[model samples]
Target: MPGKPPLLFDEAFLRKLERLSLVARRARSGYFRGERRSTRRGQSVEFADYRNYVRGDDLRALDWNIYARLERPFIKLFEEEVDQTVHILFDASASMDWPPHPAEHHKWNYARRLAAALGYIALANHDRLTVAALSGDAFTPWGPERRRRSIHRLLAFLSDLPAAGQTRLVPALTRYAGQTKRPGLLFLLSDLLTPEDLRPGLSTLQYRGHEIALLHLLSPDEVTPSLAGDLQLQDVETAARQDITINATVKTLYRQKFDAWQGEIEGFCRQRGIHYTLLTTDRPFETLVLHFLRQRGFVR
Candidate 1:
């Protein structure tokens, strides 16, 4: 009987971030001529490097004096400048709908809110934004615009995404891994209920020069299930079932596995210099925007 709750941030929330720009640990391509230096540089008054001139090269870029004296053709090569794209990959899987009995909020609803909030942040900064739903190896592109006005489009995209299918994170990510030639930022929001190996897919993105960030979302009940007796642990997405008894040792083992899994994910992100954060849907959107994400350099 429950439906998607209204998105958290309104006009007021967006107004507070109108003057800000997207921030990253390392510089990335972007618009508006900001202070953060991008990896892709051009003839923007910042000197990059020099290379030997080749056929069809710009004659003006040639070091005339070097060619005249040393009889060598050389040209200056600045970083290739381009706008940064913010790719939001939301896992639209059935498992995201699973919640404890009588829960007020669903995992998918929480994930949508966070995605919308992040979309607003990126839109306010004039960064190119795209929202995609991962169903197996398919990427359903949502918002592919580059203006503040596209925020509404993004919201609509997230609002209507059906909570269907199983999550195949590695396959979904692998599909677009080498496709995007432009280096940008990838924001993956999910409960991570996938059997797919995320490392290989993530590594592919890194190889293409993308700065990846993971936003792991979960519900309070998922962290602490209420089953105090024998229970059937069903895979929400895959419909696979596991029967088990709930006892002190079982609960302890479950919690340990959860902690270890999260720690391993954190360590993986750290090793690859990817920004990572874990959030329960119960938290406020503003808290994530103003605190957790800010600490990770999302908006500055």
Candidate 2:
């Protein structure tokens, strides 16, 4: 609790979330009624189809004009609104907690803010929302909270998760997919510096019929190197050290490698139909959520 950062959102920010809704990606029918449109007909203003009126059918739905001409009663059917379950998983790895420099923004904290904002969008739209923390430890999942009133519980759970341990994302995802009875959308926020290949976890989620979006988080130091002289870079999880000098040539190569990595990730996600976005802690998180995310079809 002492090390935890406050969820960086205010009333105005939440108001923005209220204004936006997740892009209407076709999702599986939910267990309970929600605000999103469903395949089945229910009671919305949008008229879909009509059928011969049954004795028990609501009289309000009767087509008076058609009945007057044909001497037959007909009922109207409107599209149903089904709930969507939005599951957001935060990579609580040690690297996420360790910023490359103290002055640099905290990756874990920024990730928390992004996760909270997205979760708020779901709950505010009356969609079922679940936030989960993933590491080598057992997965810690917060509620499938529904509606705006559940925001406090979502905020509380998101703010409390600590970024620690190695990233066992694949195992955690495998377990989750196995247990989940209904399919929904999933947003994964992580640096993705795992020892194992990330493809397996992503593929598993996709195979489970989930619309997956991976928002890869990075720090300014990670995107570029401003350091001079020789230094030892330590791996936060394994404590493994690599000693190197920060020469101009080395820095240039570093930048090139980083660019290449981004390209490879984008290519991979594109091939797999995963909505991949690169987010840096340097820029405004709201810009990514409100502008870039919408542009990429994450929200509308």
User: Model 1, range 111-227, lDDT digits (tens) per residue?
Assistant: 776677767666654456778888867778875665667877777777777777776888778787755555578888888867666889889888887778888888876787667
Task: Compare the candidates by TM-score and give the number of the best one.
Answer: 2
Q: Name the runs in model 2 displaced over 4 angstroms.
A: 6-36, 42-80, 100-104
Clashing residue pairs, backbone N/CA/C < 3 A, model 1? 41-79
Count clashing residue pairs in model 2: 0
The true-versus-predicted C-alpha distance at residue 172 of model 2, in Å, is 1.9
Count of clashes, each model: 1, 0
- Model 2 per-residue lDDT tens digits across residues 59-119: 9769999999999887654534325678898898888985643333788878887888777
* Superposed Cα deviation of residue 193, candidate 2 (Å): 1.3
Worst 10 residues of 2 by lDDT: 24-33
